[model samples]
Target: MRTSRVDTTIFGATSLLTLALGGVAPEQITVPAPVASEDAEAVAGLWLSADKTVRLRLDADWSYLGRVAGRHRAAKGTYRPEGTGLVLRDDTGLRTPVTIADDVLEMAGHHLFRA
Candidate 1:
């Protein structure tokens, strides 16, 4: 007599159910920690939103200036790489997180692209 074995797999919220059902053990997963950008020059430049309503200028001195509607000042601050992104410290002491991916910068729910 021959016997066959069935294999089952589950993901997300169902992983526990798989274990309870005596299915194959789920593999241990590991995620890497985010690291700050090493080369500041690489990200230094002018970036603008798709609709042209927002703009950000990243300078070589690590200082930044933001504008809305092309001329109205929205924010003036300094920026530095922090954990896979940048932390913009405004002159008023407000801090905002900006994520840099490719040629795009995401901050405060807005996406800015290199100009």
Candidate 2:
């Protein structure tokens, strides 16, 4: 069965509780490692939203900068590979998940394409 992130969190908590209560713990609780995407490098470049209102620039150093309407800052963050996507941690402590498929990138309901 495929487990969601919430499910994994619950399972981990349950395992910890069981151990704390002097119950036998399961054989092991494994956390999946982050997968390195071959597309990581390809993802580093300028991107724009469908309406051309939002612009996102991803750098090879894992840093990103986003703008709206070509001049207004929208987001600035650092990203890392997570599963088949990426986790972008912004300067304001907000984390956004980004999914890549073919030549498109999706994040927070916005679809972006290479510029």
Candidate 3:
């Protein structure tokens, strides 16, 4: 008989994980980490492309979706903080670096303003 590995993780203000094989006692894993600070949480919001042609919605869940004006959705991706900026990994597997300061966001050759 082959045993399978099971991993379960719970994240938020608290992070806990359980892992083990079927019918076996699960081992607990504790990782020390901050849930999500308000400053980092600030990234969750809407942003507009400099050309005023695109609007991107960033959710707290790391979902990054964008839409073009009067057209269909454009780019979709996930983002995580990298250094002082953020890196956007699109559906195409492209990693785009983004920098934000104040109310301005610079990414993918376009300047985005908070919307």
Candidate 4:
């Protein structure tokens, strides 16, 4: 008799596997900074592509929706306004951190001029 087996994981799904293996509880998720609602509103507006690389224009009216990577993408989520900072998220459940000051949105330390 012979038997062989190997464990495998799909790409982009490792996060889930890691959580399951480590038995990390949902409440244990660590958020670097607590987002505030007020800060989200401050960044709601039409943002143009400055570098023309990412090709993202943010439209935050009632909720956060924007295009990213030169593609027309919509993200349904909330943001916590932090003074001059904004944190965005979407239905896909991804958190995007950005800071807005004087009409400039600083996404990942890169500032995008207001359109």
Among all candidates shown, the one with the greatest lDDT: 1
Return the candidate ranking by TM-score, descending: 1, 2, 3, 4
Cα error, residue 91 of model 1, in Å, equals 0.4
The ten-residue window of minimal lDDT in model 3 covers: 14-23
Task: List per-prediction Cα lDDT, in the order shown.
Answer: 0.81, 0.80, 0.71, 0.60
List, residue by residue over 1-115, the lDDT tens digit for candidate 3.
9999888754433222222233333333222232233444678899898678878788888879877778764789888877667888989998988876666778877789887
Itemize residue pairs with steric clashes in candidate 2. Answer: none
For all predicted structures, in order, the TM-scores are 0.66, 0.62, 0.58, 0.48
lDDT of 2 by residue, 1-115 (tens): 9876654445477677777867855444343344485556867999899898878888988899888775655789898888867888889989989887777889888999999
Compared with the true structure, the alpha-carbon lDDT of candidate 4 equals 0.60
Q: Which residue pairs collide, candidate 1?
A: none
In model 2, the Cα lDDT at residue 6 comes to 50
Candidate 4 lDDT, 8-86, residue by residue in tens: 8554455675667596655665534434554434455666557654433444453655656655655566655654466
Over 4 Å off, model 2: 1-39, 70-72
What is the Cα-based lDDT of residue 45 in candidate 1?
A: 93
Candidate 3, superposed: residue stretches over 4 Å from native: 1-40, 68-73
Single out the weakest 10-residue window by summed lDDT for candidate 1. Answer: 26-35
Candidate 1 total steric clashes = 0
